[model samples]
Target: MKLAGLKSVEGAHDESAWAAAWVPETDTRPSLLLTGSLDETVRLWRPDDLELERTSTGHCLGVVWVAAHPSGVIAASSSLDSFVRVFDVDTNATIATLEAPPSEVWKLQFNPKGTTLAVAGGGSASVNLWDTSTWQLIATLQIPRPEGPKHSDKSGNKKFVLSLAWSPDGKRLACGSMDGTISIFDVARAKFLHHLEGHFMPVRSLAYSPIEPRLLFSGSDDAHIHMYDVEGKTLAGAMSGHASWVLSVDVAPDGAAVASGSSDRTVRLWDLGMRAAVQTMSSHTDQVWAVAFRPSGGSSRGGRLASVSDDKSISLYDYS
Candidate 1:
């Protein structure tokens, strides 16, 4: 597999673009790109050409993450101020406003079955699960605090959760933390299962292979990406090449490869078979914060990858 630049929008937002996700295609529209930025706005874009579709503004602080519902009609954006706004994709009408404060929200994701929304609770050391239909706070899966002298400090930033990913089967949920621990949970029972350990720095991004539900990948501040067998409780492999922190990672729909964006201001395509970066594209002048592969089965024809950066730019790539 390889990545070729398709289109890039310079100054796509007034500030750093932090997070992105693909909205599935609807009957009247093609697959669209959704991005959140430090500008306190969430913007939608048409694919291939990447034309601006619309912009939704209401966030007081920078938007940290955006997630689209599997149905493609509704989506959610979480800001640094801990507010989560769920809105209509086409109409941009407010669907719901959610917050579990003083549990600040970081990364947000919709469960594969579309029944629940899993949010990474920054500083709260837990994953906040919300029921989709009722839009109510359902459960909080708390990560077990590590035994140490600092354990007494309940608000210690060491366990600040930064990112989250749900297994393809939607039976398991995994969250990454500031102290570099990946906590896995049993979704149905809402029970904390185990921790996947390796990196000593913060793990900023994680992804589970769509084809192999047990295979997990994580990118951390240590500038390395580690693959794990979540069910087996073992490290499968580690890939390194980035000159700076690996900020975000996403697995392709086909599960043939993975793409990552880094603080090195580069986007890399890693061949899963080789377990190495097969290509790197350095186009942005600032740190790349988020990378997402467009989900399959939309009006989208081929594989597409989107990356957002601190330079306030968005780049789209053709992956084949």
Candidate 2:
């Protein structure tokens, strides 16, 4: 798949578009792209043409993260206010609202089975697992504090979790923290399993290869993307090219190429084996916050890539 710039709506929102994901097809509509922005709104875009379908409002602070249920009927968005709003993707109705006191929410993901939703709880230093049907807090997987003297603002770098991912099996949950640590948790036991360490800056986004449950990819403020062996707990590979912070990373469905969005205002396509960027699209004038490869299982023509930027624009690319 390759990118063919189709349409870009400048000033699509009032602020940065922080997150983007594809909502699978339904009976009436093919499939829609969902995006969350710093403007405190979540927008729905029709692919290929990149037409705006709907704009959702309710968030009080910047919307930092979003996730779609596997069934495509529901999706969730989290903001700086530490609250998560789950809603109906097609109807735009509220499904549930989740929150944890004093602990902000950053990133969220629904299990592959759509039975649960995992939220990255910032200050709480844990992943909150909620039952999808009842929307009740099912488990809190907290990352254990390291063996150190004391943790305070001086060490704010350590315990703050920023991003989260769930293994395809839904048995393992991985969370990235402020101090550049990624923790894996055993969902069944609700216990912290281990930590993956390498990046020294905040790990802002994480994704698991659709084919390899043990392989996890992370984008960090350090301006690099690291591939990790989640089960083995080792750094598999590190890919760097972006001149600024790497805001988001996503793997193509075929598992051969990965795409990243960066503060350098470009979207890069990296070849997995060569561990180098093969293509760079500098179409956006501002920092690109999110770049997502359209997931398979729909009427999507060719491979599609969607990117949202600080310039308040969304660009759709055709990945051949």
Candidate 3:
């Protein structure tokens, strides 16, 4: 499988494009591409052609993360101000503005079932989960610091939670921290089971196979992508090629491949069975902060991947 560049938008944002995610296709429309940037706006784009649809502005201090709910009617974006804004996807009207003080927010995600939203807590060393329907704080899954937090632990650093992913089954949750540890939690039980240990640098991104609940992929500052058997508690394999930090990762819908964006200013298409990078796309001149595969369902057709970069551009690629 490989990626063919279909469209590239230069200066898609006034500043750096820091994050990207695909809003699943709804009955009324096809899947849409959502991009967040340092310009403090979240813009929606029509897929394939990359036409601008709408720009939602409310965030401040730059939007660092964006996530679309499974239903496609709702989305979320977070800025450096440590606030997560939940809003209507079509109207851009505020649904909820959420914050857990003393605990900053990094990345945000909606579970596959769309019942909950998970936020990576920066300083609290925990994951804040909110009930989707009520938009109320439901639980906090804490990561144990057996050795206690080091004096060097700070609010915005990777020492705290930086990224998170939900298993395909929705029964499990995993979070990555700056100290290079991935914690797997049992969602129903609200318990941390164990840590997936290997990389010593911060794990910036993570994704679980859409087809396999136990298979997990993690990207980190170590510049390598590690594959793991989450249920088996084993390091399944590792792939290395990026010269810089692996900033983001996402599994293809069919589960045959993985896509990653990196500080190397390159996007890679990895063949899962071969455990090798089959294609590398260097269209961005700066760090590629996020890469996301459009979810398959409803009116969705072929495969598409969207990537946003610090170069202030958004690139669309057709996956085949």
TM-score sort, best first: 1, 3, 2
Question: To one decimal, what is the Cα RMSD in angstroms of model 1 from the true structure?
Answer: 1.6
Model 3 per-residue lDDT tens digits across residues 192-247:
89888887898999999989879999999999999999989999999999999999
Judged by TM-score, which candidate is best?
A: 1
lDDT: worst 10-residue window of model 1 = 146-155
What order do you get sorting by lDDT, best first? Answer: 1, 3, 2
| Model 1 alpha-carbon miss at residue 251, Å | 0.6
How much is 88 displaced in model 2, in angstroms?
A: 1.2
TM-score per candidate, in order?
0.97, 0.95, 0.96
lDDT of candidate 3 at residue 15, scale 0 to 100: 99
Count of residue pairs whose backbone atoms collide, per candidate? 0, 6, 1
Per-prediction CA RMSD (Å): 1.6, 1.9, 2.2
- Candidate 1 stretches greater than 4 Å from native: 147-155
- Local error of candidate 1 at residue 191 (angstroms): 0.5
The candidate with the higher lDDT, 1 or 3, is: 1
Off by over 4 Å in 3: 146-158
